[model samples]
Target: MEDEVVAEKTNRQVVEDEVAAEKTKRQALDSALRCLIQGQGGELPPNVAVGMNSLEGQSRKDGNT
Candidate 1:
């Protein structure tokens, strides 16, 4: 029973770590895209803007600000 409990905790920690890593990756990608847009004169291209908006909406739905 103790080993099983330890295993479950380890699995949960792995999942949490993966989620944190994913959030970090998402932030990095967002920063890179913003930098690219800024290099293009502070305006996001229409398609990119639409996609970003959709992603933001989904992020909000997922309880992330």
Candidate 2:
């Protein structure tokens, strides 16, 4: 049926969107880590640490432990 095909396409699009979002998040996290490493223990604005920690915990698997 046409409705079934539309529903399947919508589901696939949702999955693709999720994959794109996760990839963008990971790239942002990696960039942040590189910046921190280059900073070499310098004091960061408190929000920087908070942001990084939250991003670390944002995964579906809860691997931030």
Candidate 3:
């Protein structure tokens, strides 16, 4: 039926949108990691920000985690 086709199309569009959003999020995270490394003289690895325990703890305490 026509309604079934429309529903399939809508579902596909939703999946494609989710994929695009995830790609965008990855790109943004990459850019932020690049900035962090460059600003710190490229001395640390990609996920160094995650290893910043003190700041992370502070943020959690402040409810900004």
Candidate 4:
């Protein structure tokens, strides 16, 4: 009865939260790809540029493999 209703609501909220998280994750990946494309041309969004620099540094430290 009331417990079933609460359970249904909880299940719906969990689904909504999962959808939101997946959307956010996809958006972040899309943005990173765009930044990488721009970086190939020597331009980058400031935030992504920092991450790219860090990645490049790490690659160099790992012997440029």
Which of 3 and 4 is ahead in TM-score? Answer: 3
What clash pairs does model 4 have?
none
Give stretches of model 2 more than 4 Å off.
41-65
lDDT of 3 by residue, 1-65 (tens): 99999999999999988866765675567568767878988655535655654444754564443
Report the number of the highest-TM-score candidate. Answer: 1
Mark the regions of model 1 whose C-alpha exceeds 4 Å error after superposition. Answer: 53-65
- Backbone clash total for model 2 is 0
Question: Ranking under TM-score, best-scoring first?
Answer: 1, 3, 4, 2
How many steric overlaps are in each model, in order? 0, 0, 0, 0
RMSD in Å for candidate 1, one decimal? 2.1
lDDT of 1 by residue, 1-65 (tens): 99999999999999988977887688689879998889888888799889887877876787776
Residue pairs with backbone atoms closer than 3 Å in model 3 (clashes): none
Error of 1 at 16 (Å): 0.7
**Given candidate 3, what's the lDDT at residue 65?**
31
Tens-place lDDT per residue, model 4, 1-65, is 99999999999999988866765675577578877787789666799769856765764574542
lDDT of 2 at 11: 100
Q: In order, what lDDT does every prediction score?
A: 0.84, 0.72, 0.67, 0.72
Query: Model 4 RMSD to the real structure?
Result: 9.5
Q: Which one wins by lDDT: 2 or 3?
A: 2
Which residue pairs in candidate 2 have backbone atoms (N, alpha carbon, C) closer than 3 angstroms, thus clashing?
none
